[model samples]
Target: MPRSPYMHLPPAARSRTVTAVLGPTNTGKTHLAIERMLAHKSGLIGLPLRLLAREVYGRIEERAGTDAVALITGEEKIIPKAPRYWVSTVEAMPLDLETDFVAIDEVQLAGDLDRGHVFTDRLLNLRGQSETLLLGAATVRPLLEKLLPGLNVVTRPRMSVLTYAGSKKVSRLPPRSAIVAFSADEVYGIAELIRRQRGGAAVVLGSLSPRTRNAQVELFQNGDVEHLVATDAIGMGLNLDVDHVAFAGNRKYDGYQYRQLTAAEMGQIAGRAGRHTRDGTFGVTGRVDPLDDELVEQIENHHFNSLKVLQWRNSRLDFASSASLRASLDVVPREDGLARAPIGDDINALEHLLRDSGISTMAKGPKAVELLWDVCQVPDYRKIAPANHAELLSTIYTHLMQDGAIADDWFTRQLAFADRADGDIDTLANRIAHIRTWTYVANRPDWLADPAHWQGVTRGIEDKLSDALHDRLTKRFVDRRTSVLMRRLRENAMLEAEITSSGDVLVEGQHIGNLLGFRFAPDAAAEGPDGKTVRAAAQKALATEIE
Candidate 1:
């Protein structure tokens, strides 16, 4: 059998020291990292997206065997007793591990203003003897090499082009084939088009949950999906095989208006094609805008291939204070400020005024609002905030009540109400009615007390449910023959039938179901148009076997 592509890597690349796998897209860097883990016996893989992490876990299991792999993303954890291969999001990864290797799949995230520091710190200082591999798009490849001088650099120039359909004047796609757009509206628009024109490809947004994103990938891979309408969330380690990648939109959210894609971004996404063996058709397609021919030319020329150093700085609202827009500005020079009066009300406002006074360089316009949400969720946000923090606290509290633990939601709501009489009215007014409705359905005495397994319904509702309902439901379910059979199946309980040496038993096999009188409905699926019923098939199979 042929060796896997991941199996053969140079010793220099797999040493017990930091190693960098910097390159353009589709260079198979992630696979290389996995191979290093396999050879070294243990390692942790960090991916930016949960879907990618989950997929990595599945692949590792397929290669290493069940229970040999573990997944630790935000959504779920399959922690093996002695897991040798762990897959997780960068943030979810344990701060310290005794493993032989740590690989950050999309290391260029070091340029992100929000979570970039985590990856940068990891690249700069990881304590174990284990090796580290930083994989990312080509634009930031030089930055990693500069930061880590001992790092090994590998560059795989993209071999594919992005192609698309539309008139030249339509510069940005309405959302067709992986179009790059800045706003949520553009993504939705593109998604709608794919749904109508190309048989409905999955819409990929940065904020979508891991489970939902994986479902989309599955649909695409299984041929049920046509296009993948996505944001930059798919730019990194996602493995979506496509014959043609079209930039449906040009404007990327750079803090203000949706602007055109930088050469680096165009190159980053184009690299996704011709991945593994590289014998496929991959190209870039986009609408041409006469106003921005220079950008188009740069994209076509691949001038963005040269490594450019970028700092992680972006504008953001100062949720710390009462004033919103003034949060992320700069201060004016002493000489200029001395001649003028105090600029703005708060620090944020002053900072913005300083920008007007030519005090600071204009950074990327805080392109990602999702980053703020994640940061706010951090337990330390309170420690970072200034006074008058109620409104910010309220916003964070609302989000938690919706997405966090149910108990936490109830506790926070109660705490909010206790804090102030107005707090209760404000909190209740802003809250979605569905959350309360769901709470009611989830917590009703009859529902809770019912004998349903309940685990699938919600994990934390068990204690809150009425004991009486639980007992009643349990008894009813346990008494059912079907439920009993399912339990037996789950337990892998074997059925032992006794027989005489002459083949005449205490009871003949021919009348087995008659004794039990239970139908083994093998075809207990939906009714089909062929006129054959699943229950009938099950009955026939049971009858044939027994007779």
Candidate 2:
């Protein structure tokens, strides 16, 4: 009997008991899952985001001891030789390992246009020997009932109050505010506005590394910073002390197209403003038009569109070859009137790679498809333009297949070229992306003879690029008018500048400060103006030069 590619159950998955745990934000859905996972002798959790995966991994380790849990994401992996509990991003989840329990967080993303296929696949395939928990928004109930007959459905509620606060400007935002935007530029723009008016803001976005996001989140959580500017990525279980969420824009560009967020999405994002034990308010800002009254009311009232069909894609291993798989992908969307896998970017890149007649003609059978898919699965760490990224991937794929190993000099030359920073924000992002790609490649113990050395070197480059990007973002987004050198402006040959009796301080014809009421240099406090102080010898240097 041929099974629906969408529902091709792994043989063992049939023996598991499945429970669909449904809820909105602040609900105890994940909390319950964690409790169950801890209670079970061994367990695995699949999270939609790397950040969320790390969060759960840490919590599990704290309770189960670090060795009991393993963390795996596409770009990073930390695991014991025999991990008792595997915490991983959905695609990275170790399905081959059996555990007493399994849970998939944000299961409703199964209908997500691009990333949903993996979720649906996980929902259909991965199962624990004893228990399997599928966690997500309640909107998925119908789909679950239809797709998984006999599945148990459990619902949970918001632990705190969530309401629609009338839309307003950034300046009027409250403390503990989170300004959500769709694009990096918009996130930065709103964050900068908040910094100017409200001190500095913690910036969070999808492209940031897990470590970077954690540090940024810590800044907001510690009360050192009052506001956070982020993308919709925060909606998926990334908790914070947010009392308000103001949307800088209501629309977003999904990988394929720009579209209005669904009622479900709007509600998910708004729900983040409030948490257990605290009421939260949400609204629109940064010149974005307010959500239509009905949509606003829907989100406020928790009314959302129901899920009908699960979004899915063929993982049909029977495809004769990589070429055949691409052909099927091209035809299936049109044949079925369904969207091609939301996750087709990588495969699309692979197609471009195979465009060379030599590569295209040499491929046939499932083995070829598997090899191509493996190459496609490589992360686009460089985040270059899709075509350019695909071109590079194609080149690398060709080299790896033909040459077995990437040339050391070829890879090093790219890094050497990336050593310079561009002033333009987009260019800096590109450089960071390239370093990230290098870092990713460098981490593969199988790919490099000395993975540790290359990993360290690549990390140094990534860190340099990341720091440069943060510095650029901070300077552009923050209001630092109280001091001159604090702009981190280029240094001058002058020993140091003095504060004028009028309080106008400058060195070498540059205006520096009207001290923000700090005794002594307060150089660290004044120049570094981060909620954290950046110490400088400004005060001591100036005093010494004068004496």
Top lDDT model: 2
Tens digits of per-residue lDDT, candidate 1, 1-547, equal 4222122223234333666666656667888888887877878788886678877888889999877888875435567688887888876776556667778777766655446645554555442345667676666655665554556676665545433223422123222234444455666565554443333445556544344456556555654444566677777768776654555565666533556666677656655544565432223333434324554555444456543433222222343432233333332212110111122123332333233322122211332222233323322212223332323333433333344422435433533322321223123222212122233233322223331222223323212232222232223212222222222333444433333343321211211222233323231222231113223323333444467
Q: How far is candidate 1 from the true structure (C-alpha RMSD, Å)?
A: 16.2
lDDT tens per residue, model 2, 1-547: 4222124574344425899988788888888999999889889899999888989888999998877889877656677777788899998876567688889999888888778888887887777778889999988887777667667888887788788888788878877899989998888777776665556788888887666677778767876567899999899899798999998887888877899888899899899987787899999884887677898788777778887666677765445777567766554422221245554677667767677676676556666556666667777766557778777766666666666667778788878966775666667677767777777777565555566677778777766766776666656655443223332332333335667776655544444445444544332334324322223435534555445
* Model 1 TM-score, 2 decimals: 0.54
Question: Model 1 has how many clashing residue pairs?
Answer: 24
Most accurate candidate by TM-score: 2
Off by over 4 Å in 1: 1-16, 127-130, 157-180, 197-199, 254-258, 277-547
**What C-alpha lDDT values do all the predictions have?**
0.47, 0.73
Error of 2 at 366 (Å): 5.1
